[model samples]
Every structure is written in C-alpha cells, then in structure tokens.
Target: MLKIFKKYYGYQWLAAFMLGLVLPFIGKLLSVSGLHKVIWFYLIINGLYTLYLGYSVRKRGLSPLILFALPAVFSGISTLLLHLVSHQYGFYFGLMYIVLSLFTFFGDTRDDPDENQIPVENGFRDLKSETKNDGQVSVDGNLKV
Candidate 1:
C-alpha cells in the first residue's frame, strides 16, 4: 500500500481533497463550528502546497505550471477574500478550487517528453557471442556442454 501510494501524486492529492470535502459535512453533523474552520484552514494550506508543486514541476519543464497554479491560487485567495467581502461568492470560489486542483492533480505533466526523458524500456537487446568447450555456465548465462 505504501508503494502504491508512492507511485503517484494523485493519490496524495485525492486524500487531501477528500478530507477537505468531508470535513464540512462532518462538522455539520457534529454541529461544531471549530471543525468547520479547521477544514477551511486545511483547504487553504493544501492549496498553497499544490501551488508549490506546480512550480516545482514547471521548473523541470513538465508544463506551464503558471497556467494551472495561478488559477488555483487565485481561487484560494478568493475564498479567503469572500469572507471579508461577502459570503455569496465563497461557494463559487470553493468550486473553482476543487476544479483546478482536480485538473492539476490528474494532468499529464509527467507524460511530457521533456519531463520523462529517460527511456523506460528500449527494445534493443544486448548482443554477445559465447563459445563453450566444457559442461559449465558461461559468463553470459549460456550453457556449455
């Protein structure tokens, strides 16, 4: 399970995203205002972390990180600002964050040739000739009889 988790960033992002999604519901169920605030804080922090991730990937020439990260950061900031301005736009900002995060999380940045320069599997096999005289295994894994 750890190996599987380590295989993709999407898994980590998904976990964070799900927590953000369920926290509000859980708060409502328990009638806890503190829990709701905590969830919102988590969402903001995660948004920042995701923005950092985009910058790192972009540094590696994976893709245009700004294209994705900008919107995500904007959405997060908007959410916070909505509290000061009006709660009417808060939901819209939250939706934008969700959409941007999902898109960036599942995006094909790693698939870019610039990012994945190493050839995973080359079809060409190493060629070597072996001569055998006695019953033994050769250096190249060839049997000599």
Candidate 2:
C-alpha cells in the first residue's frame, strides 16, 4: 500500500503545480481582488483538497500536507510572478492559506470507534445481532437495517 501511494503521490504534486500555473491565468481573466479574490483562492484551495481527499478515502495515500503546503508556496510565488496581489496582501494570503488548509484537513478527519464494532468490557464473548432497518444499534454492534 505504501508503494502504491508512493507511486501515485506525484499526482498530488502535479495537481498543485498545475493549479498554481492555472490560477494566475484565471486571475487575469476575472481580475478578482478584495473579498472576491479571497473567495476565489479559497475555492481553488478546496478544489485541490478534494484531490487529496479522494486518495485518502481509499486508505491508499498519506497526508494532505502535500496539497496544503505546495499550493500555498506556489500561490505565493505566483503572486510574485503574476503580480496578482501586493506584497503585503500576498503575505497574508499565504499565511491564511497555510492556516486554513491545515485547519480544514485536520478538522475534518476523525478517529472515532467504528460504528460496526461493539465495545467489549471483558476478554471476549459470543454475541449475535439482527437488524430490521430501525436505525438503532444493539449492544453487540449490529445495524437495525
């Protein structure tokens, strides 16, 4: 699994780089600034997030730090390259991106107990469960259909 992820991880990098390349072009077209520019950047960042998220769901990939970090760096450079935002604005933009992406990624993930697994106090015991779709969970960890 690690090998598979290592092989495909480049895809995440490539997407971020491509996003950087494309964003300046899109900015040129829309000429967005002020609140709109922030919204635009946010949307783009989250769009990249979905790419990282897809891989994560399969348990076949690693962190979104690639998506978060690369795009922030590239977007900062892009502001320099394309003169999209002033230096001060660009700085804040990059900082916001890093903070927001990290928060977004970490905030959304969870390590809760599996809904299908029942809690056991003792060592082990035989148990059976049936469900009829009543949206309730029995003590032995079975769905009510």
- TM-score per prediction, in order, is 0.32, 0.50
Error of 1 at 10 (Å): 5.1
- Per-residue CA lDDT of candidate 2, range 1-145, in tens? 7677567676666655655546655765787665665566545564456544544533433555564644564556666777655565666656655555555455544442353575687834675447544476889998765
Instruction: Give me the displacement of residue 79 in model 2, in angstroms.
Output: 3.1
Runs in model 1 lying further than 4 Å from the true structure: 33-39, 56-91, 94-145
Candidate 2 pairs with clashing backbones: 133-144, 133-145
| lDDT of model number 2 | 0.57
**lDDT of candidate 1 vs native?**
0.48
Give the per-residue lDDT digits (tens) of candidate 1, residues 69-112.
33333344433432321245345545554555555555757665
Task: At residue 97, give the lDDT of candidate 1.
Answer: 49
Worst 10 residues of 2 by lDDT: 52-61
RMSD of every candidate to native, in Å, equals 11.5, 10.1
Indicate which candidate wins on TM-score. 2
